[model samples]
Target: MYRIFIKPTLILAAIAFAASFALSHVNKITRGKIEERARQQKEDALKAVLPPYLGYTIVEKNRKATVEGIEFFYSIAQKNEGEKILKAYVFECENPGYSGIVRSIVAVDEKLTLLGMSVIQQAETPGLGARSKEMASNKTFFEVFFGLSRKAASDKEAVSQSWFEAQFTGLDAGKKIGIIKKGEWSAENAALRQELIDHNAVSAITGATITTKAVILSIEKGIAALKHVLEQENNAPGEAASP
Candidate 1:
């Protein structure tokens, strides 16, 4: 009885060991492939999000700040001919939304004016929080007047809801951004308009107030983190601000 039981247990153990070994081997092989694909996709994403221009070279850099374990990836846009500076950047910030962290990247000129930005990563609720990436309006923000002149009312509608991240273009990072619900069509409230006009305000996503706030907070943090670099570049005695 002892001999029979011992042999059966040994056989079972050997089979289990062999199965685990096979799985580990498969995992290692697949992991390498997955990593390679991820790297390629990241490179593509970084390239796509940059300010669109021809003959500019991107120089990538990663930096970790002492505060809040913030890590950012940045790129310098350099001209091809004389290697002149086209645009400068101070890149990413991770801010917590209702569901999880929202990671964003910014592109700025020498004056630290926000030029372009991309939401590179996010982990949030599907319909509500995720709408941060969408435009406030899928159609024209405000429609064009008489098929000729463009008015602010119609222009507002043109902004992409799916690309809500692009709304930050041309914002001055010096001022704090307040989140508001008012848009071009609705202006009954004077105080909100005053607040928006007085302060650099961003219109929040409908039903996604938390996500909108998260985005604003992330940008604020990003600006804070980039303060030193911006000051050094913009305040240099002999430096001329980029147009």
Candidate 2:
């Protein structure tokens, strides 16, 4: 009985230990690559969301602050021209979505005007909530299906800006932004897109209102935290307030 039972138990234990060790080794080997990919994704998101200027510098890199017990990370970008300097603040925000957390990078100016937003991470359902990160392709279905436009597409530089994210550009971040259930946005429909922008609203992804709201709510909370931090900084002794 000891040989049959105890020996099998020991064998199983050894297998489990070996598996765990192998997994640890694999993780160690790939950890740096994973981190590097994540960093690149964040850097791309920051560039996509930041307000356009002739050229800009990252004045503050990965600054951290806590407001009301919630920690926030942000970066400041500056563009200087002659005697004037323009600045933009980019904040990373995450909120629970239908399937998982939706993380985004949002940029705003000194007057609380939203410059842009880019969804950096999300696990929402495909063809629905996942469309939040989908870009409106300029190619027609036939061109894509037949690979007729491959050369043209490859020649042109790819842009990460998505229709859902583009709606947030030039919005009033200090106030509530609205969402409407008017079909998905199309890049070719300039009139309809402009109409949505004029109303300070974004067209919600079909059948994914929860994910849409999650992104908006995250941005709002992040802006609030940033406002608190800025206010504190401005009030600090000998600190010049942001203009």
Candidate 3:
């Protein structure tokens, strides 16, 4: 009787082991496809912000190894048939939203202008900060940075940096982009501030100032990160355009 029961138990154990091995193999086989699908989804979001007539390529094919401390993927979008690098970028960033982290990517043209940006991932209050992602209306929030450049052309101010990073739009690369201190800013900066106010200048979500600032600083840091990268690129040898 004992022998008869033991044999049946052993057979059941062998079958269970076989099933586990098969599932493991299937997981390995499909992993590549799964990863590819995720990558395509991200690519679609980034491309939406870029101009339709422009062309671009991935400077770094993989996002994980490109930048440190930032958990999202990034790529440089270049526009030109060839040889001309129109834009240099690092994509995807995380900021605190009304409810949670809001993630996005910042793009700068070869001339160091903020070309466009997109929110790739975010979890904010359903109607407030979440609105930051709306393509139709929320777009103005991002467009505020277009053609924006640093205020001080000299390394002194460029390197000084700001906790609440200045938002200066329509700025050429070699200009002093200023900001308003509630009332002290010049007409130009005040206009910029008003535009941001009209479009939501990193406004705190109704009652969620912490969450709102998180998103604001995230964009700020995103700009800072790109600035740092561009500065390095400008100093790199063999990258100078021939006259």
Candidate 4:
């Protein structure tokens, strides 16, 4: 009875313990690398959303605050002349999308004009909602087939900005940014794109109005939090308002 039941049970328990220990050791070894990669990804997203102008230094404050009972994180970008010139405030926000959460980084200037926005994380539908992060390729199929594409030599440079996210740039963050179903935006249609920009609106992704509205809601909530924090900081005793 000892060899048939008790001994086998003890051996299986030992094996399970050994496997758990090995997994724990492996996790300890790779934990730092995982965290570092996440940090780097976040830093890259911050840089992507800021204005394209040169000489601005990004400082990741990672400050935490709450507005309307929701927590938010923000950072600042500055230009160093003789002194620090406040360039833009970058805020990270997320909202529930059609399939999952869609997170984005948004940059706005002192006057609340949106500098840019980048969708960093999402698990939305593939063809429709996930297109929010899709980059527009500068070269067409025919251009590539003829080998006449300017970026043919470097495929990595062939893609331009994410059309969905790029539409938020230069819009007013202080006011309600609108959304219209004009069509998927394209650089080729410069005139129609300008019309949407003039209306302070972004063209909604085809068949993904829920995902589009989720991003807009996230931006609106983030801007409101930023305004609240800025107001608090400006009113603090002996502290000048942030430029």
Which one is best on lDDT?
2
User: Per-prediction RMSD in angstroms?
Assistant: 9.1, 2.7, 13.5, 3.9
What does candidate 4 score on TM? 0.79
lDDT of 1: 0.64
RMSD of candidate 4 to the truth, in angstroms, is 3.9
- Please state the error at residue 141 of candidate 4 in Å: 3.1
TM-scores for the candidates: 0.60, 0.88, 0.48, 0.79
Residue 146 lDDT in model 4?
86
Q: lDDT tens string, model 4, 1-243?
A: 999999999999999999999999999999999999988867766666774564566675778887778888888777766774766788899999998899998888888988888888899999999998787665678988987876665764443348898788889988888989986766787987789879999999999999999999999888888989999988887687444
lDDT of 1 by residue, 25-104 (tens): 99998998988987875664455445445445566576444444555445566554566556566477768888778887
Error of 1 at 72 (Å): 5.0
lDDT of each: 0.64, 0.86, 0.51, 0.83
lDDT of 3 by residue, 1-243 (tens): 758998889888899999999999999999999899878757655554454445666566434423356444456756564675565564556776666677765555656454455565667666555644432211233344563433323423322211122332222222222322342222345664566544434223344455446644665666556666656667878677744
Error of 3 at 160 (Å): 36
Candidate 2 residue-wise lDDT, 45-75, digit = tens: 8778874452767899889998999899988
Residue 164 lDDT, candidate 2, scale 0-100 = 87
Candidate with the larger TM-score of 1 and 3: 1
